[model samples]
Target: MYKNIKVIAFDADDTLWVNETYFRDAEHQFAKLLSQYETENKIDQELFKKEIENLKLYGYGIKGFILSMIECALELSNYNINQKIISKILDIGKEMLEKPIELLPEIDDVLEGLQHRYKLIVATKGDLLDQERKLEKSNLLHYFHHIEVMSDKKPTDYLKLIQHLDINPSEFLMIGNSLKSDILPLLEIGASAIHVPFHTTWAHEKISEKEQEAADYRTVSNIKEVMGLF
Candidate 1:
């Protein structure tokens, strides 16, 4: 269906590899640290919800997430936080930075198949160091002709990337997990998008109702389905 697409841009995190799994695991460990102060029912689930809500206001990234965990810890512990508990939370944040990058099943094959026919670019939003490290570790770094690591995925960012790659927006295709960050803005710019939903998306990346209704967007269950576009 997308054979005319000359440039195919992919979102790195949950789209090409396993990212949400790390965040979910870290959150579970974080909840465990708070279990002693407040009852499991009150502290874990409520705090997890608070953190998710905070993500919309503060946005995603280790810094904001760590801060939310710290706030939750302090609140639950009644300002008498244990040093070891604090250390463990910080360690969880560090572990995310050091987590191994494992690409989704069939991602490599799909990219390899399309590389010959179209220009591939990776457009991901996150800390630059983290994103770069992931691309390097995944061994899929060489597949993309361009890499855009940004703090946000606004329409301007998409336009800039398309311009930088010298491709018209209509001729480019974006495949990603987040409808908010990946699909909507690109679609607003007249680009095509394929949505590959992740089971545990960060709260901030969730799509709004209005953005969900716009443009040439297609949804797939897995990354491999993206190959059908070629």
Candidate 2:
């Protein structure tokens, strides 16, 4: 299927290493910390809402999440949230930022196997510094021809990237977990994509059943399965 593909772009967060799991764990910690003011379910809902609202102001990654937690806590507490709780929230964000990069099963093997045959690239969205740190820690930096830390993943962004790489849309293939961010956009622009489902996905990245059904892309059970597609 990828016989004409010259560039294989990868999404670095959950696709390459553990990311949303840490966010989920942090959310649980946050709910417990603010439980005095609201139920865990309510806290989770409010936090998700706040994160979405703050996406424009803070963008993505741990720092923005931490800020949203603080904002939610203040509103939930009616501006009476304790300083200690705020400090605890900061600590949680710190721990998340400091967590070691844990690569998913077969990530290295897949990269190693394809690096020589294709122009591998890291096309992901997140805080630039954090993404760079994870990529460095992953120790697979040497494999990619380029690293694009996108602010947003849209068809236009992918078009710009394709131009920069000097490749036609038909020569590009993107692999990621999110259908909304990774697969649909690439497919919309005449590029191919492989959806490697992650065990956990943020609500914002979820797509409708009809959208998934209509998407003209291949779906794989795991990242390693991508090897068979090419």
Candidate 3:
């Protein structure tokens, strides 16, 4: 469908692989740790809610995630937990960092199918090291012509990437999970975008209003269906 498209950019986290699963697991573990000092009710749902709120204020990446962990730990513990408890939470974050990288099913086939026809690029926002580690470990690094790991996913970031590639916005298409980060910004700049919703997504990655109206935007059930759009 998009045979004329010259560049296809993809978001890296939940779009390509399993990211929200790890964060959800970490939050559960975090709640377990908080239960010792606070009531289960107070620390249960509210803890995750606060963390999600923090993500919006601080943005996504390891630094913000770690900060949210710390904040939730302190809030649930009521400022009484010892350093060891805090250390354990931080250790959980580190453990998440070390976990193996994996991709969604049929991702390889889709990439392989598109590689011959379009310039593939990974344009995502997150910690530089963590994102690079993920790409390197996934063994999918070689498929992309360029990899953009930014602190934020804004229209400017998309503009910058397209400018760097010397490609027209009309010739590019972005496929991703987050409407906030991936679709809206690219659509704002006149690039086409495909939304592939993940089963679990960080709260900060939710879609915005303008993104919902872009004519070039399309939604697919999964990564495999994305190839059909093009």
lDDT of 3 by residue, 66-156 (tens): 7777877776667777798889988988988998987898999999998998899999888888899999999998899999987687888
Residue 158 in candidate 3, Cα distance off native in Å: 0.8
Best by lDDT: 2
lDDT per residue (tens digit) for residues 27-115 in model 2? 99999999899999999999999999999999988899999999999999999999999999999999999999999999999999999
| Candidate 2 Cα outliers beyond 4 Å, as residue runs | none
The sequence of per-residue lDDT tens digits that candidate 1 reaches over residues 98-120 is 88887888998999998998889
Q: List the residue pairs that clash in candidate 2.
A: none
Q: List the residue pairs that clash in candidate 1.
A: none
Q: Which regions of candidate 3 fall more than 4 Å away from where they truly are?
A: 39-59, 208-216
How do the predictions measure up, each by TM-score? 0.87, 0.99, 0.88
* Model 3 accuracy (lDDT, Cα): 0.82
Model 1's alpha-carbon lDDT is 0.83
Candidate achieving higher lDDT, 1 or 2: 2
Best by TM-score: 2
What range of 10 consecutive residues in model 1 has the weakest lDDT sum?
55-64
